[model samples]
Target: MHTPLSDQLRILLGPVDLADIDPGATPGAVSHEQTEDELPKLAARLDDLQRRLFAAAQGGHSTRRVLLVLQGMDTSGKGGTVRHVVGQLNPNGIRLTAFKAPTEQEREHDFLWRIRRALPEPGEIGIFDRSHYEDVLIARVRKLVPPMVVGRRYQLINRFEQQLTAEGTVLVKCFLHISRDEQMRRLLARLDDPTKRWKYNPGDVDERALWPEYQEAYRRALEKCSTDEAPWYVVPADHKWYRNYAITRLLIEALERIDPQYPPGDYDVEVERERVLASG
Candidate 1:
């Protein structure tokens, strides 16, 4: 039997608790294996839920906006998650932004200036491929900024997210939790496949050298910013199919919670064959 939306959502919204998982584990290394036959059913269920969300969003006015932030180490499937999980959303109401290293002009401004510019307008959904959390993740991992400044950014981010939620944005942050082994598997695949060679970067190896520091950075980011208004859901990314299913399920629930409604209208009885009843 297919799982109910409420139960699926509960599992999706439950604590990520990465501390309990091994740092060096692969995506599916520790979890129970799923049978290949189960994938089609799971995919179909996600597609059905996504269709409902789109219908609700088309009619409902209460859903102001949704901002989904995706953060993870290279090969953790941030781009892939975006591709599969939200692939079917109504494009007219969605925006995707990918953040990279700062330009000279961007470097001159405050860290958040660019981020603020990318926020979606009311009634839209914004997906960030990488985000301001870069301020904490990259800066902390490489010591690029002062320790004091970096440490303070955590609370600043929490307050910033809370303010966004207060103002009508629904924020969902996801950290793709992939084990080192799974990362290496993906990294090697990138190198080995000619079609995927474009994704391989020498800098990835450099980052792998500082894996421990990145792990600490992620730990602190989750601990500090997972708040009531904008919480983080760390999806286990070893099994790409499961990761996509989990994220899509969570998003459908959030959209449903908004309960979009159609504008009121009356049927035109004069144009219909059936007789219209007179109002009292």
Candidate 2:
């Protein structure tokens, strides 16, 4: 029997050292071509599930929703994952937010306020490009917040997530794990290819210098926040295709378990069919 991809890729509650995992290794599957072949079928399944979820909401049958939190380094394919993976589902069924550095107005509110505002509506899929976790990941690594404050934020995050879960949000948290060497290579590729050159940022190189600090920060966040209600999965992301495939599989599994069925119409199907036929 085949193991579920989530079990193979999920970060079990424990200490997480990014250096220990191979970013290029494909988890639970064999080849890139094999994954490529499987993507369309997976995408079709997602399309049907998303539509059913939306239909259930429109019929006032369910309040359940999904929030996909994507956390990764600069070149870890977070945006690419959105474009290639979550992009498979219907746009109407998805609420996407690419959280950049907070603005002055955003800085005035609690960190989670902006996060809450961007949450998915009932039965929709919310995709966070970089999420509230940055409060711990980047904030801790750069000393943007006091150590005590950072410590407190972890507990607060746990509570905030639990609150979300209690309110019918199913969280799918993902950490796109990539090696330092792979990051450097991708950043350089951005500079080399004219099409990709627009994405090149000198600041990313500076951040790369603090790789060890970032790694430690990520480890700390993963350990502190991988709660049972909403645990994080570490996607080995040097292989972009596998990252997309694995995440797609994870989502399908979650939605299938939810098993949202299309709600029945209020009026008889025969009546609607006769009315349509008569109108034509």
Candidate 3:
């Protein structure tokens, strides 16, 4: 029996050590050409499931929803995954939000307030390019909040996620694990290509200097917040194809598990057909 990729990539029980796994590699023996070939099949399946989810919600048959939480270091291909993977799903059912530095108004509220506003409604698939975890990750790394405050947000996040799942949201949390060496190469390439230079940030190099700190932040976040309701999956991301493939598989699995059933038509099909014919 083929083991689901979720079991392989998910951090079920761990003190997350990012160094233990190779970011350049994948959990499966699948090849790049194979992944490319398999994506269309995955997309087609995902499309059918997503449409079922949307259709179910339209008839009030289900309140099912999906939320894909993506977190990673700079140049870890979060955006790339969205373009390559999420773009394959129906745009009408997607609600995407890329969280950035908190605005002054946003800072006035609790960390999760903005997150709650961006959550997917019934039958929609929500994508968070970065998320509430920032309250613990960067907030701890940069000392944006007090150490004690950072300590508390972990439990807060866990409770929040638990409540979401209780209300029928399937949460797929992914940490795009990339290596330092690969990140340096990509940074250099960004500077080398004029079209990409716009994405190059001098601050990125400064952030790179604090790599160890950031990794520790990630470890703490994963350790404290990864729960049965919302487990974290470490996606090997040095290989762009594998990262995309892994995430696509993760989404497919989550939706399949939901197994949304399209509701029966409220009106008789034959009557509808006759009414349509007479109207014509």
Candidate 4:
């Protein structure tokens, strides 16, 4: 059964048309001010949840971890989301990997090899800036791989995620949905501001030309790979504040469901306390 939270975020577990989602839409009439006001509270809750999850793992009571896979086109605020939403948590418990173009060494192995190595440990939360989905997304759009190979990768990804979930890793895949117009605006903004110019890539304009193809590739990937254990959520990211709020809410709700609790001490608590008291 879908939780109310899942339904609220339009979590994608099946077929979905990218065109159907308005990138500017927010849940209900939520305002940017409201979202900003609530963000700290949600972030606090997320921090507590993360601590409990880590504590459980330290005590050898939790094998479950969280993997947050963030995917979006250029200028969709992937960096901003990481900064505002995920930045609140304890850095020690967070494992962040920003996937770049595969190295020659990485290319030699199957797509999942590097990704598998980066998976969060039992107590940690792993954040993938761009993940194995690139094998299907950019590879499909750029024809980096044969169609038959890309087709096979979808199945491989699903099986890989299934294995992760079976072994106790929770997955939250988010597509930071932004419209073409908004993307162009952001790209142009990057060019206009000297400080942001470093973020501007001439290659982004080249990719922008292939926007439709990328969208289709993303659509297919999201539809085919969203499983019960690892569903994808389309986050309307045109409004940065709302995007942070929504993603933070989704994460808090997910952790609540997991309900990680600090494990009891293995040794006798009273004896340990008495020993400490005597030493003092």
Using Cα atoms with residue i matched to residue i, what is each candidate's TM-score against the true structure?
Answer: 0.79, 0.95, 0.97, 0.96
Ranked by TM-score, top first: 3, 4, 2, 1
lDDT of 3 by residue, 1-280 (tens): 3468988988866677889989998886468987788777888999999999999998756988999999999999989989998998999999999999999999999999999999999999999999999889889989998999998888899999999999999999999999999999999999999999999999999999999999999988888888999999999999998998899889989998899889898989999999999996
TM-score of 1: 0.79
lDDT of each: 0.74, 0.89, 0.92, 0.88
Q: Give the per-residue lDDT digits (tens) of candidate 4, residues 141-184.
A: 99999999999999999999999999888888989999999999
* Regions of candidate 1 where Cα sits further than 4 Å from its true position: 1-17, 22-63, 265-280
The numbered model that scores best in lDDT is 3
Candidate 2's residue-wise lDDT over 204-238, tens digit each?
98998999899898999988999988888988999
* Minimal lDDT window, size 10, model 1: 4-13
User: Which candidate wins on TM-score?
Assistant: 3
Clashing pairs in 1: 27-238, 60-260, 60-261, 64-123
Q: Is candidate 1 or candidate 2 better by TM-score?
A: 2
- State the weakest 10-residue window (summed lDDT) of model 4: 1-10
- Model 1, CA-based lDDT: 0.74
